[model samples]
Target: MEAEFKDAEIFKRMMDATGNLMSDVSIDFNEEGFAIKAMDPANIAMVLFEAKNSIFSSFNIEKPIKISVSLDDLNGILKLVKKDDKLKISDSKNKLVLDIRGKTKQHFTIPLIDENYTAQKIPQLKFTAEVTVLSSLVKDSVKAAALVDDSIYFTVDMPRLIISSKSEEKEFSQDLSINDNKEIFDMKSESTTRSKYSIEYLTKFLYSADSEKPIKLSFSNNYPLKLDYEINSDAKMSFILANRLE
Candidate 1:
């Protein structure tokens, strides 16, 4: 298997996002693209990541392969990538080879993990509400809620999506509506729905998000929250956080 990316930025960002929850991942490379589905140790959250072969500058794979690798080691090597640096990846026996090319050339090899990982199945959740809004709005709401409470509430009331949190006397709330806020691109709900989620998880999930792009959120009352972040047309990430019981 051999693949070359024009830049390592997206790969680095992906590792950064998933590393918050998992120490390692088993990535599946096929003729179509690459995919990974992993759940955090606590089992409170799951991350689904996919990148199409089209996203790579060059991609070649004779047969399907699943390689498990330590995120720490991979992230360490990716950190060395300078701006606009190209990354070449290949596998040799039990080792994964990474080549960085920019002002200078560098090569690093890390052993592939020998452990086996069962692919996580994504939950088929029926959400009553769905909203699409600028990532910056979600980031700001999470940040504000973090300052006051450990858990945040997402309430869908008609055309408005309300994010709020409360800790004793301290509280934070941000109201976003498709009719009033340009940041809220769309909102739909069959009925009023509200769900609470961990602020810590939400914060980490949005940490690497592109604030300029819109994020899709889906949830039902007391149901898990699914947040979808699109890096591009070919690269996308989806995070699911179990609702915190009141």
Candidate 2:
């Protein structure tokens, strides 16, 4: 089997996103494309990734396969690819090979990591509130929260999305009003919802995404927060973060 990515940057972004939460991942390659569903070692955060076959310039497969590899290993090679380089990938008994071709050529191989854990199945959660806002908005909020504490409180209402954090030393909070910014494209709620999450994990996800892209968020009081973003034209990635229990 051989696969080619027209834009290596997209694959790099996906790796960056997963690497933030996990060191190793079991990636499934099928006719549909590539998908990964994994939980952080601490089981505090879950990440789901899906990139459709259409997104790749060329994708060929005889049968579906699952490969375990270190996110750091793949990211390392992708970082070396030139802006216009097309990425070609292959796998063998115990290693994955990457060929980066553009004005110049580069080749690298990484030993596959052995994975013993099974992929997790995420449930369909019903959230009381939902909102779509620019990724930069939440990214900035997390940055502010990090200055004060390790966790941030997300308070979502019909008219606003509030982020707050406090520690013994200082407190910080930011209210993102719904009506003012066009970046807040859509919002709906039967009632208000609030939850606290680790700013560290939230920043991991945010930093991997495009600042201008829209992020759809869903949550309920004291429940896990869900964040979704379009990885590309045909791919989408989501994260489910366990709420901080006080």
Candidate 3:
């Protein structure tokens, strides 16, 4: 099978995001697109990523295939790809050939791993509150929490959407208008809803939020949080992070 991509940056961003969570990954490539669902080693967070055929400028598939690859190895090969390079991927019996073409063509072959792990099942969750906030705001809040501790708490106090973190030395809180759905967020929470999560996972998750589009977060009291953002046309990413309970 062969697949060509005009935009490697999107794939790069996605691979980077997935690599932060797991060293190896299974990418199921169908005629429509590629789908991935994986849980971190600690099982505290799950990632679901999909990119449709329409998202690619050019797509040619001989057949549907499940390709398992080492993210570390893929990253090494991707480091050599230039900004305007067009990427082509061809599959052999046990190797995936990656070629980047621009001024000159660079070819790198990666050995595909055997598909041995079972796929993860995404669960249906009912959340009491959901909010869409600016990606920058989320980054700022996470950074603030990083300064204090490794964990942060998110709470919905009606109009105020709050994020707080405390350490041995200091505590930080950021409050944004939940009513301003256009900018801050659109939220629904009657009670003082709260959930705590690890800042480490959050920081890696937010690393993929390079766009200005608002990030959607949904959760309930002490329940797992679901976060989602659009990567581009026909491509989107969603994450479920288990809440930290004391």
lDDT at 175, model 3: 75
The clash number for model 2 is 0
lDDT, candidate 1, at 14: 86
Report, for all candidates in order, the number of backbone clashes.
Answer: 0, 0, 0
Error of 3 at 221 (Å): 1.0
Ranking by TM-score: 1, 2, 3
Candidate 3 residue-wise lDDT, 120-225, digit = tens: 9899999987878888888988988899999999998888898999878999998777555456757777687899999998888988886587899899999999
Which candidate should be chosen as best, given TM-score against the real structure?
A: 1
> Per-residue lDDT of 1-246 in model 2, one digit per residue for the tens?
579987888888888888888889888999999998898999898988899898788888889988889888888888888788889998877989899998887888899887876869896888998898899988888888899999999887768878899999999988777887677888888877888889888888787788988999888889899999997788889999999985
Residue lDDT tens for model 1, 52-75: 998789998999998889999999
Better of 1 and 3 by TM-score: 1
The global Cα lDDT (0 to 1) of model 3 is: 0.86
- As for model 3, its CA RMSD to the true structure in angstroms is 1.8
lDDT of the candidates, in the order given: 0.91, 0.86, 0.86
Deviating ranges (above 4 Å) for candidate 3 = 179-182
Better of 1 and 3 by lDDT: 1
